[model samples]
Target: MWISPAFHLKVIRAYDALVTQQPHPGAIDIRDPKQLAIVALQLVEVNRDLQAKVDTMQVAVDAHHRIAKASAGSRCVTDAAKDLQVRPKDLFSWLSANRWIYRRPGGSGWLAYQDRIQAGLLEHKVHTVERPDGTDKVVENLLVTPKGLAKLAVAFRTPNAA
Candidate 1:
């Protein structure tokens, strides 16, 4: 019911044009009631067209959420970040604030939270990487479960944690 300033001006012009038979407004003799009705009908048709578009968009968003929840799974942070088309820093921020991941003293990378690991919502993995100098190093990372991934996705997608 909130009328914008532009729309208010349009309504005023429509009323003036329909009711006052004189184009410049000093009273010409030919007033037609049907002209006012036609203007009102045009406004109703425009409202209906916009409402239809809003309804269709809502249906598509609901379907997307349902599929995202059902298809959640365990994935490495790097891969998950890539799949979501977001920077790794944003994903890490959500993990850190929620305490679903942590870092050990002097630890070089992220680790699974002890509680989530025990609760079967997360797992840990170790892999070896070879450097160009022919040296090998072991790295640790977390594997998030379906339930955990789905919940975390909600947080990461929501704006400002609200």
Candidate 2:
């Protein structure tokens, strides 16, 4: 149920697009918002596809971690590997292919998808504060407002439903 805020906003925007579509008499029949509808569905489908993969891996990881914990002296990654029996590289490949995770060389996949969601939630406004010691500072999480959600929802909703 841990839906990324970005995808949620995307869905909301898709819904909004459908709701606010104006009839283009010359481009298409006023009775049908074909182009708008098609775009909306595509956005929703992309979100769904990515979400399914994230959910699938999370479930497998969770199961593996649980068993590892019960057995004692098990690290999260070790348990995850055991439960899923997938090589780290392969797992990264899977996550990367879905665009929900990015490869990090020696480290496990980075949660770029989560970062995107956080950025979107913050109203597309982000500030990078650098320290005097030449160290990079962390950015605050973006908050997804109702308006953003509405926009994505409209963009993704079926055209006929509008």
Judging by TM-score against the true structure, name the best candidate: 1
Q: Which residue pairs collide in model 1, if any?
A: none
Per-residue lDDT tens digits for candidate 1, residues 100-122, read 78888997788877898888767
Candidate 1's clash total is: 0
Report every candidate's CA lDDT.
0.69, 0.48
Candidate 2 residue-wise lDDT at 98: 51
Candidate 1, residue 123: CA error in Å? 1.5
- Model 2's number of clashes is 28
Candidate 2, run of 10 with poorest lDDT: 153-162
lDDT string, candidate 2, 48-109, tens digits = 99999997566544544434333433123223333345465654465357553454579532
Report model 2's TM-score to 2 decimal places: 0.23
**Model 2 segments more than 4 A misplaced:** 1-32, 74-162
Q: What is the lDDT of residue 110 in candidate 1?
A: 85
